[model samples]
Target chain A: MKIKKVVELLNAKVVSGHDHLEAEVEFCFASDLMSDVLTVETENLLLLTGLANLQTIRTSEMSDISKIIFVRKKNATEEMIRLAAENEMILIECDYSMFKTSGILFSAGLKPVY
Target chain B: MMHFEFHVEGGNFLKAGAASSQLKKILKQLNVDPKTIKRVVVAMYEAEVNIVAHAYKGDIYIDIDTKKIEITLIDEGPGIPDIDLAMKQGFSTASSVVREMGFGAGMGLPNIKNNSDELTITSEVNKGTTVKFATYLNQ
Candidate 1:
């Protein structure tokens, strides 16, 4: 699924990396645990996380994850946004809980990493 | 061989993985295989976080060559008393503050072991700990 579609479906706001909305992501992984997020080894993966911090961006940097959805109305801090922009990461914010965001995206053809 | 050294300040969440990030870029610029680079980054990042979350201060030393990349992390902090216990999944000594940042879920070492081709750990209770790992580029 394209990140653009995800933004549309979840009513998410793009916090960074607006230039890459047309990029397609084939897999999705939802986790608040950075360690668990680091365990994933998939390409074109979209991370659905509620953890809004610089470490989240660092985790994405290490794991090669370029797109993220911050659920439950979690706001990315300025530092997080700056790092995301630097890494060319598309960070999205939504009011939906992690469960609802995952359900909607899963129903919309986003394959789970597991 | 290319050798790089980086310092890590313990308990500073903001600067935890800076070294790993830098190493990832270097690996990419050197034309290392993407898969190999990912493995190196994952393991290195986790180990780097371990130092930040537990140690007083740390140092990262990286050596890369045509065949493989070797990394060593040494830290001065409250070292692991039981290496066996520390390696267990889901067992962690991270403070509440660290947990809130979505880390300290006790998967760091296991993740490192999973991603690296070879791994070793040594520690002294009050002195510190050292982690060394390698990933083969040609594998």
Candidate 2:
């Protein structure tokens, strides 16, 4: 799924990335633990996370995940957003809970990489 | 196998993940397959977190080769009392502060085990912990 559709599906606000919203995402994984995301293969995936920490961006970078949709209305700090943007990751903030955001993205045709 | 070592700053959350992040970057530059890089990074990242979250003093050493990538993490923190108990997925002794950092959730070892082809952890009471992980290449 293209990132633009994902933003609209969840009524997300683009926190730092909009120019690259046209990026294509191939998979999704929702987890608050950076450990889960690190252990799992989430390449080209759109990560659904509520935890807004610099480590979140680092986790996504480790797995080559470029699209991070922060659910539960959580937003990344300015430094986190800048770091993600510097890495060319498309960061989004959504009001929907993690479960609902996952459902919406799934129904919109985004699946897990595994 | 040829060896490359990387250092991680202690108690710095902003710099906590640098070891694994650099490993991923170097692997990519070497043209290693994406999946292999993913596995290596996963294993390394978990170890890196462990170092920051626990040891309070340590370093990460990475050895990369054709068949596999080997990562060795050595930390001087008080060693684990029971390696078996520590291996459990939800087992953690992390302070509340570490938890707020979104780590210390007890998934570090299991996640490393899940991502690596093989994992070996050795620790001595009051000494430290040494974790060795291997991620085999398939492509």
Candidate 3:
């Protein structure tokens, strides 16, 4: 799915990487634990997490995940935004709960990174 | 062969993944396979975070050759009391602050082991800990 579609479906705000909305993400992994995120090995994955910290961005960068959707309306700090921008990672924010966000995306045919 | 070294300050969450990030970029420049790069980065990043969240200070040394990349992380900290116990998933000794950051789920070592081709860990209770792991470049 295109990141733009995710943003539209979840009513998410583009927190960073506005130019990369057309980027395609093949899978989604939702976790608040950074360690679990590290365990995922999917390519072109979209990370859905409530953990709004520098490590989130770092984890995404390390895992080659180009896009992140922050559920629960969590705000990304300036440092987080700066790092995502520097890494050319797309960041999205949504007011919906993690469950709702996942449901919406899954129903839209976004597969989970299992 | 290429060697890179970095220093890590414990509790410096902000700078935790610097070494791994740089290594990822270098691996990309070297045209390492995407799957290999992902494995290497995941394992190394976990090791790096272990230092930031647990140790007092640490150093990361990477030796990359045509076939593989080996990483050694040594840190001064209150080392693990039981390596076996620490290896179990969901077992963590991280401070509440560390846990609050969504880490310390006790999956760091396992994640490293899962991603790396080989992994070795040694620690002395009150002294320090050292983790050495490697990922194949041609895998």
Highest lDDT scorer: 1
TM-score of each: 0.98, 0.89, 0.96
lDDT of 1 by residue, B29-99 (tens): 99988888899999999999899899999999999888889999999999999999989999999999889
Counted clashes in each candidate structure: 0, 0, 0
Give per-residue lDDT, candidate 3, residue A77. Answer: 95
RMSD from true fold, candidate 3:
1.1
Docking verdict class for candidate 2:
medium
Write the residue-wise lDDT of candidate 3 on B92-126 in tens digits: 99998888787889999988889988899999988
Cα lDDT for residue A17, candidate 2: 72
Q: Which candidate, 2 or 3, has the higher TM-score?
A: 3
RMSD of each: 0.8, 2.2, 1.1
lDDT of 2 by residue, B1-139 (tens): 6688877655678887777877887998988888778777877887887888777678778887778888899888889999999999889998776677778878888888888888999999888999998988765
Q: What digit string (tens of lDDT, one per residue) describes model 2 on residues A36-68?
A: 677665457778998988999988887788888
True contacts kept of 3: 0.90
Total backbone clashes of model 3?
0
Docking class of 3: high
